[model samples]
Target: MKIDTTHLLSAIEDYIAKADEDLRDTLENEGFVAASETVRHIGEIEDALEDVLDEDALEFLERVKEAEGVDEFLSVSWPDIKNEGDLEKALYEIFRQKFDEMFRSFTFSWILAEEPEIVEDISGEAIDTITKPAEAFIKGWSGELSRIMNLNTKDSMEKMLLKAQKKSWTIDELAEAIGDSGIRNHGYRSRRVALTETLRVQSYAQQESMIQNPLAYSKRWKHIMSDNPRENHIAMDGQEVFKREMFELTGRNGETYLVLCPRDTSLPAEETVNCHCIMETVENENALGMTADEKKELREKYIAEVNEEYEAWEQKFKNDMGIEEPRDDPSVTWEIYNSYYEAYRKGEIA
Candidate 1:
């Protein structure tokens, strides 16, 4: 269940590349990204931004044109999104599917350790391995997207307005000054979310592996940072420190590092977003401490807990959304969505 950083990062890259291609398809001939500087429209920068994009960006520009609200567009359009084609939702679903498939293979790998003769599915219990973390993944993904969007739109628009006050500017001038920050923000934020989600799935698999076969390995968690050629100092320091340390290592200066877990980090932004660090669980002698019966009991209890958590989430989702959970789909995606949305609605996620 350790973080396979290489595999995980490649997964993220594939997702981003796919997302960009999908978004481009959505944008193609949609009047979302402006193509030409037709004569009458060439005069003003505002017109370019207005005609340059539609969908969310156009919605935002409409607010500006009408002389209305500041944060007029999607103050996070996730709530209104219903399908898979949405940028954020699409990103989540991609990782969800990939991670689920990977974890299926991941869960099956345990069979190879002792019972090499048979290949069997955990059947009912397998869904929990994905649903539980997926619940958190969506919530985190939405939160991070909102944060990046707010900062990018507020700051970028403010600077654009400031510069526009001084003199008239062309489409290129204003765009260069303000930048297509929304795209940048989304791209960067998506990377962070994708990386984090992939790791989380791996972490859950680790948990599942541990519970199912406690004696298989006394798995100790370790932080495995990337050998990214463009790695930064904070990541380097994190790599150096946790590279040799174990899980739950505490700093002499009272800083705490949850090595294999997510969030609650003391690292600066320089290390987190686009970060290539990962959690790796290695076997230790203590793995043999738990007896066979104890391992089975632990595994049963864990699966039960995961099932309860997702059931509760699904129930709440049904209660709150006034719709039955998706009966046709194999994934607990809607259930996870409901859980995370409630968290966001109650302000518990932040």
Candidate 2:
């Protein structure tokens, strides 16, 4: 089949534009939940375009003709190119990889939309491509379009963490390293707290319901809580919450006990940040070598610790926010309580 470069390019550009729009929506809404799906679909479309480009190698030859400033050149047939099939395959593979890389650039922007520190390093071409439709026509295909862009956002974050670790920096330092000044300054504390508390309540409700209603648990919460509790906490909190949980499973030989312990939020003035209290699990006698009964006792100890930590943190948050007294009415769910607390603290709802 003859390749249709114009049609293929148009389709690719259109898909890319739609992908960019979706990415923007994700950014504006802080919707990382939907980001990977959006990017995956865009990647699939880009791959199809690469296939079209491979089939239409003649269009590339036409570009070469224009580049050499010749009205016409010897028409190069597909077979005339050296190892044309392998060459076309290699070219398309390279093109697809490059397109994926570009898509990743946009994806990273979406990921970090709240903080655009990397924007300066992004290419004008990338920005333009994301902002406008691809050019109507282009007659050139010798070297690949070498846009200077980095798509290794995960690597960047890892490097930042490593640098911070080397310096023995705390969570506040780590947050700053990742361009999250809000975390450092406790600026997003309210939203972070609300999100964290909501997730925590949902998690607690699911777990309680799981014990009470195994069928409902199997239907709804089973898969969600499949991870080790600490990891599950991290996934739910994401970057919005910078707290950590440690789980230790203890039991006698052939028996199992669970204990949960949560570390305080590592941010400076964590109390002011309205951080969520974490629960840690301590397992008995399996690997960590604690007796089963000891594990149970420690679990209770940790719960007490968690409550004490939260009480202090909550008191400070209230003080900073100018909440003179804690709410006594049972009507105060954690979410409503924190929202009111945050508003009062920020002087928004006073």
- Give the Å shift of residue 267 in candidate 2: 24
On a 0 to 100 scale, what is the lDDT of residue 266 in model 2? Answer: 17
Which sections of candidate 2 miss by over 4 Å? 1-202, 205-288, 329-350
lDDT tens string, model 2, 166-252? Answer: 676655444444444221232233234323322232223222211121111121111122223333334333112101211222222
Residue 205 shift from truth in candidate 2, angstroms: 4.9
TM-score of each: 0.44, 0.20
Ten contiguous residues with the weakest lDDT in model 2: 131-140
Clashes per model (N, Cα, C within 3 A): 4, 15
TM-score of candidate 1 versus the correct structure, residues matched by position: 0.44
> What are the clashing pairs of model 1?
1-206, 32-53, 34-52, 218-287
Q: Best candidate per TM-score, number?
A: 1
lDDT of 1 by residue, 238-265 (tens): 3322212224444334455444332322
Please estimate how well model 1 matches the true structure, expressed as its whole-model Cα lDDT.
0.42
